[model samples]
Target: MKKSIKNLFYFCLPLLIIYVGLEIFLHSLDYEPKTKNEYLEKNKNNLEILILGASQTERAINPEFLDFNSINLAASSQGIYPNFCLFKYFAPKLPKLKIVVLGMPFNAPNTPKEYTSPIVNHLNLAFYNVNTFGRATMPQDYLLFHSNQDYFSSRIQNYFRDGNYSNLNKFGYDTTRFYGAYQAANYNIGKINKSEIHIENEHNSKAIHNNARYLKKIIRSCKERNIKVVLYSSPTHFLYNEMRDTNLVYERDSLVKNLMEEYENLYFFNDEDNSGFEADLFYNANHLNPIGAKKASSNLKTFISKIIDNPKSF
Candidate 1:
């Protein structure tokens, strides 16, 4: 009996140690909380526009050009769940906020198998600490919280390599340094292939419906507060537009149009248009480089001004 008890203890010890270590490491990389807290401290009740979404918003929108005080709270691959969580956390604190711009792209995957939901983190839970995720309960909240497998590993490496938390700028935008031009293959200096960038049959109704639930929740929340919601698809390379338009695969585009029809306060921008951007402005098929971002921001400023002036015009 004594020997069996000792054997069981020995077997469980290493796993216990690893589990504890992982928990500690994840908490250490809670850089989002720190970045958010700092932004709140500086701009609490001062933000007029709050940008939320994945990486596109982080790289594309510069709050400096906007007519009102603004902050970008977007992160790379952060997705709609995080967007909802972050908005829930900051919306109440922002007394002057008039608009919430969500960077929901055309190709945002919606299938359950595509990615896990309740992608909440310990830091986010500690701050936002909500019991529910839109219409669903987030079971992962009580289980274990890591941003994602890849992000978790990257954060661990970054922690050991001098604690690099440079992703968030003072304005709450990710101003990661990039240089040189985007490399394109089999295209002229000014032309890009549409087939390479178009995402057809990549999403089904289930996936779109799942994401749309949270989007509707956000819209309702904003509506209750009398704030407008702008759902914008950031610029993709011209190839996406040319290919999708020519091939006539409008699954993603159709879903967005339907959503626009459903909600009066929810607006869509540049959903099917890429004429506003040149191929050289993109870093890859989906994201824009700095020059492209500047042009997008300027156009957005004009659109926002018009929206602010004529609420029912769209």
Candidate 2:
């Protein structure tokens, strides 16, 4: 029995060494969570604007084009929960944070729970020490090496097999493929896989309530800090807008308008229509290409310039 035990221990030693090495390698990459957290920690005093949201915001807002000192925390599949968590974690540290820009497109009200992408929860906890998982974040979530085998393995493979270290720019904007989600959402959205972005065509009462709870938390946090909260709807192609359920759109618009009335610090800028962002500017039915991001950033600059201080003018 002693000889058998000794043989087993020797067999597992090399496997353990390889596992630890891979863990360190995966954590060392310039993922958005790690780099963005580092950036925010280093520049907490100078951040005037902190933009948070999912894919639509990722495609539209580029901080370099803005006049203020800003950082884009948006990424693909990031919902309101993660946005709120990130804001809550960093709000206290940012002395110069005047505004929080949230990317709230037409379907934003339908942001489902974090279980839709549990890896997001783990990513937040592992990198930024922010908890988007609420009560579901387990101690095991911290052990990314063991808990998320496929996700980490894919990242490892991507890093080694092809040298694809990261898709994020220095500003944390994901310079990756953005059209797949919007393209899949263009036709027969009902049949498209719901894993990527939130473009549900039907009215979901639960999703609306869940998302609203977090949205209100973010607004109230900003209210307490005396920071302005700007929630804007990014431009969507006419085809995408036309395909959406009109009633759902109306309900979402009404929800946002109602919240705006309730919260004095809350402001909304809607660019969901073709307002100069015609077919030529879109990468797909929802996301913008490089040219459109420039145009969108310029348009956003004009709007934000007007509302820098006066609420009445806006």
Residues 185-206, candidate 2: write the lDDT tens digits. 5644454443444355756788
Best-fitting candidate, measured by TM-score? Answer: 2
lDDT, candidates in the order shown: 0.66, 0.77
Candidate 1: minimum summed lDDT over ten consecutive residues — where? 111-120
- Which runs in model 2 stand beyond 4 Å of their true positions? 1-7, 143-154, 161-167, 175-198
* Model 1 residue 149 distance off true place after TM-score fit, in angstroms: 5.4
- Model 1, residue pairs in steric clash: 110-207, 111-207, 194-239
Tell me the lDDT of candidate 2: 0.77
lDDT by residue (1-314, candidate 1, tens digit) is: 99999999999999889977886657555454456566766887788888887766767786766667887766665667677778887898899988999986655534232242334443446444543334444544543334466766766787788675566556645455344234544224345444355354354567667777778888989988889898877777655544443322355557667777887787877633667676567666667766677778887888888889997888
